[model samples]
Target chain A: MLAKRIIPCLDIKDGRTVKGINFVDLKDAGDPVELAKAYAERGADELVFLDITATHEKRKTLLELVEKVAKVLTIPFTVGGGINSCEDVAQILKAGADKIAINSSAVRCPELITELANRFGSQCVVLAVDACETQEGWEVYLNGGRIPTGIKLFDWLKEAERRGAGEILFTSMNHDGTKNGFANEALAEISEMLNIPLIASGGAGNMHHFADVFTKGKADAALAASVFHYKEIEIPELKNYLKSEDIPVRL
Target chain B: MEKQNIVIIDYEAGNVQSVKYALERLGVNAEISNCEKTIRQADKVIFPGVGEAAWAMKKLKETGLDQLIPQLKQPVLGICLGMQLMCAHSEEGNTKGLGLFPVNTLKFPAEDKVPHMGWNQIRQLKGKLFEGIETESYAYFVHSYYVPLNEYATAETHYIKSFSASLQKDNFYACQFHPEKSGDIGQAILNNFIKL
Candidate 1:
């Protein structure tokens, strides 16, 4: 049986982790490498570093950080944010990232997905879709869920899969940060539609939210940020809870 | 034991850096090279691959590794696509493999998710590759195709069905999972391989 994964997503800015991470023992909370090592030690199945840095010059810092993180961490990690081309992905993978997630760049040119899948293999390509519920339907969003693309979520997801996206990381803007729950209805539909793995993101407040995402949403993995960063939910404890609920997790 | 000369074959198949880093953590430095002479000289060779079968086979053939690999006398371990390529054939890309394992790689039936991603257990363990590792230990796996149960399989994992998680035949060993990324249990397996 393939175990459901628990991932901790960290926002990176100028090679440093943004958004307060409340680990008391952490020597440097802003250090992405240290935070990543901590999360992995606590039973995080994987880690995602979303580089939020704006400047092109700062991109080099992210690559250095990725190399440092890859050297120390044993688990799989994905590097995303501002990855635009095959060259960018090559550098990241060369820097030792296990996978690379592309969002807006993929929307701008869908061929990038096929090219990446062909060159680097589909296993390392992750298509992250930011979506929001609207009067029309679950419309895909861009630029960190600020701009709407008018494309329906299901339609875009179908295209992404067809374009050779190995996995889908779907984050619902409406439910994100609400601490309410996941968009299970939409997630279940997407999971049913695609053959690849689906990673449910956003609206993860409690451990039950994790359970709901896996059981109700049928997500192969669940990713959360603040809840994990602030110690609102500990990974080992959460895995124990999931195990009790009959959800398969690596202990 | 004197320092073992380890070489990880690099043919632009996929991420070989992760494998190097994993070995580094074990205090063993492994040279990453595609050169036939370097691979032929190493005491142990690690063939790490990730990607399409036919395409990888093309790359291997271009480097003349397709001939050198099957003849190596030292212990040679293959990972993921490396493991699949050790088999006789693959349904992916209709690829003919190295024919070392006498098995065939086939795509997972569409009854479940295509790629068997995330952590899964390897059971019915046999051979020194899994020494000191418990049976049913979890290892990280990410692939759409799998090698069905066969005589060469030293370990088995059940996804859509029981498939070869690890295979061993004489000096050749292979694993369908990414032991480099499988945390403690995976590290232990790598340690066992290094000792072998």
Candidate 2:
């Protein structure tokens, strides 16, 4: 059986490591290459580098950053943020990113998903969806959760899967930054709906939260930024905890 | 003594850099090339692939590497689709493979979830690639199709069914999983391959 993954997401801004809450007010974490090596040594199953403020210059800078980090990593790492076109993805992958995640670009042009999957294989194309639960219902958001779209969460998820997305990086806006717990109810529903792997991001506060996300939420992988970036939870020991809980995590 | 040369066949499958970096971290700098001369001179050759088999085979044929690979005297290692391409055939794209091993690659039943994308345990190991690797240790994987257990299989992993995790025949070795992305255990596998 495949083991569940524990991933640490690094929010990269201005070519340095940064962490943010609800996608705002960035805090410097450390050097990306340094943090990446630390995570890999500590048994992080994977790592994600999301360039928060991805300007044209910052994109090139992040590209270089990905290269340096890639040189030291022996684990699979994903690069995201401001990946608008196939060309951008190509450059990132060439710089040693095992996978590429697209957000706003995928919303603006769904065909980019198919294009990436076709050109690079579906295994490396991840669809990152930022969704918030509202009184009306759960809906998709764009531009780092600033704007809302007419597309509902389930509808967009189904469409993304149909368009050859290999995995779904579902971030619940309602649960993000609160550290209460993952949106287990929504994650369970989404996992049940899709056969592909679901990476539950946004609300990961503690080790037990990781356990809940896997056993209750049925997520194949759990990604968190603050918990790991701030040293609130150590990855190696966390994997031990998950193993004790029979969560089947990579140690 | 002449230094050992490591070559990663670049058939446009991409992600070859990760493989190169894995070796360089172990003090073995690998040269990525598709040129016949560079590849033919390798002490150990790493055939890495990540895309469609038909497209990969087409790229190999274009560079005349398909013809060159089988004739090499050095130890050749294949990863993921590179491992599948070493088989006699693959159901993906209805393509015929290099036939280095007489096995055939088949897709996981649609009823059973596919792409098998995660780390899974490897057992029943009996090859140099797994010398230092702990039994029951997991290796990272990402593929829908797999080569079933065969005479060439050196290790096995279970998903929808028991499949060949690693295969060995003569000087040729291949792994269905990505050792380059599997961290420490994977690094050990690559180091073992270099020693071979």
Candidate 3:
């Protein structure tokens, strides 16, 4: 049996973590390396760095942060956002990210998935899908979940997998930032339909929500931003809670 | 403590940063390079990779690094695709490997659950890599192919079937799993490697 993965996602803006970390013991709220080290120390299975840098001048700083963060932790981490070409992927990977996630860029040019898969192995390629429920069905969105692509959610997932996506990271816009619960119904559908692992993201409120997403949602991994950033739920505590629920998670 | 020199071969196969970081955590200094001279001069060489066997092999040749490795007397560690590339040949792209281990790299049956992603405990631990480590310790793995269990098996793990989780032959060593991504247990394994 595979242990369910617990991943912490951070949005890096101007070489700093956007949602400031609230832990009293934490030395630097703006430091990406500090946050990642904290997560790894707390038993986070992986890390995600999303480039949301507001200023173009800070791009070099973002890469520097990636390198600095990559040095302290041993856990696998993925670098996402603004990776539009192979050159971009190469730079991020060189900067120390174990994997690369392409959300907006991948949707725009689906072949980018294939190109990356061909260059690197499929094991490190993550395809993130921002989906929202519509009258017809769940449709994918682009540009930080602001624009609707009108692409059928399930259809796009199938193509991405066909194009050699190792993992599909599905974030339900309806559930995102709402903290009500995960879009388990949608996740379960995608999990059953695909052979690869699925990471459910966006509506995590508590440890129970993580359990529900793993059990009810059939997600191989659960990712959250605000909950972890604000120190609402510590990763080790969550893993212990999952264990109490009989979930096979790495303790 | 004087740190040992470690070099992770960069065949453009994938990120060696995690491996480098893992070494650093053990108080060892490691460098990443595809350069023959840098690799040859290092105390220990790490061959880590993430790509198809055939394409990675092509890049190895293009860099003319293929001729430089395998001749060194120092211990060499290969991870995942690196381990596969060290074998006799891989079913992936019908590619010929370095023949360092004289074993075939095989893909799991397509019908079966593949990529064998995630944690599986290693039993029957042996050799320097498992030094001071308990048996049945888990490591992270993400690959569709595997090296069959043989006499060279240092550790064995089960996915579809029992396979060589780690191998040691002569001065060469390899692992099908990513020790760098594997946490404390992984760091222990790496520490053991450094001690060797």
Candidate 4:
């Protein structure tokens, strides 16, 4: 059986982790490499480093961080944020990232998805879609959910799958940071529509939320940040909870 | 014990760096080479790949590795696409494989997810490759096609159906999962392969 994955997403800025991480054993919470190592050791199925760096030399720092993380971390990790072109992806992969997630760049030019899938194979290309529920229905958002694209969520997801996206990382902006729950209704629909794996992001506050995302939302994986960073929900304990709930988790 | 010469066959099929780093963590420095002589001379060779099958086959043929791999007497372990290519054929791109494993790789039926990705358990362990690893232990997997259970299978995993998680035939061993990226169980698998 394929176990439902538990992922901890970290925000990176200028080569260091940006958000406040509350791991007491961590010597340097800002260090992405150390945080990643700790997460892997503590039973994180995978890690996602979303580089929020906005400097001209951001790429260099990100590449270096990826190299360092790849050297020590044994589990798979994905690097996202500001990845615009194939060249950018090549450098990240060369730096040893198992996968690369592209959002705005993919929306800017849908052809980038096909080109990336062609060059690097679909397994490594993750299409992260930021969506919000509006009166017009689920509409896609860009620039970190500040701008609306006028594209319906389902329509765009169908197009992305056709364009060779290996997996879909759908983050419901309406539910993001709310600690309420995942957009299970929308997620179940998307999971049914696509053949690739769907990773449910946003609105994971507790261990039960993870269970809901996997069972109700039908997500292949669940990704959360603050809940994991602040020790609000420990991964091993969460996995144990999931196991008790009859959810297949990698323990 | 004398230092062992290990080579990771690199044909630009996939991320060989992860494999190299995994070995480095185990204190085994492996050389990444596509050279026939380098691969042939190593005490152990790691064939790691992730990509389309026909294209990978073309690259292997271009580098003359298609001919050199089967002839090597030293232990050779293939990962993911490397394992798929070791089979008789693959439905992907209608690729004919190295014929080392007497089986064909077929795409997962449309009823299930095309790419059977994520952590899955492997059971029915048989060979030294899984030594000290418990049955039903999980390993990370990412692939569209799979080698059905066959005589050479040393381990099996179930997704949509039962498939070869690991296969062994004489000196050659292969795994459909990325043991290099499978965390502790993965590292242990690699360590076992190194010891072999």
Give the winner by DockQ: 2 or 4: 4
Q: Taking the tens digit of each residue's C-alpha lDDT, what string does model 4 give over A18-87?
A: 6532211222246788889999999999999988664557778889899999999999999999989999
List the TM-score for candidate 3's chain B.
Answer: 0.97
* TM-score of every prediction relative to native: 0.97, 0.98, 0.93, 0.97
For candidate 4, give the docking quality class from DockQ: high
Query: In model 4 chain A, which range of ten residues has the least summed lDDT?
Result: A20-29
Per-residue CA lDDT of candidate 2, range B1-196, in tens? 2367999998889879999999888888889999999998889999999999899999999989989988988999999999999999999999999999998999998664567898899999988889977888989999999999998999999998999999999999999999999888999999899898
Residue-level lDDT tens digits of model 3 in B51-139: 78888889999998777777878999999898889899999999999889889999887554457777778889998899887887768
Candidate number achieving the greatest TM-score relative to the actual structure: 2
Identify the CAPRI category of the predicted complex in candidate 1.
high
For candidate 3, the TM-score is: 0.93
Total backbone collisions for each predicted model: 0, 0, 0, 0
What class would a CAPRI assessor give candidate 2's docking?
high
Q: Estimate, for each residue in B1-196, the C-alpha lDDT of model 4 and write its tens digit.
A: 3588999999998789999999999998999999888888999999999889999999999989999998989999999999999999999999999999989999998878879999999999998999999999999999999999999999999999999999999999999999999999999999999998
Candidate 4 has a TM-score of: 0.97
For model 2 chain A, give the 10-residue run with minimal summed lDDT.
A242-251
lDDT of 2 by residue, A156-235 (tens): 88988999999999999999999999999999999989978899998898898999999899999999998998899999
What TM-score does prediction 1 earn?
Answer: 0.97
Give the alpha carbon lDDT tens digit for every residue of A32-120 in model 3: 88888889888888888888642557667878888898888778888887888898888778888888899998999999999998877
Clashing pairs in 1: none
The interface RMSD for candidate 4 is: 0.6
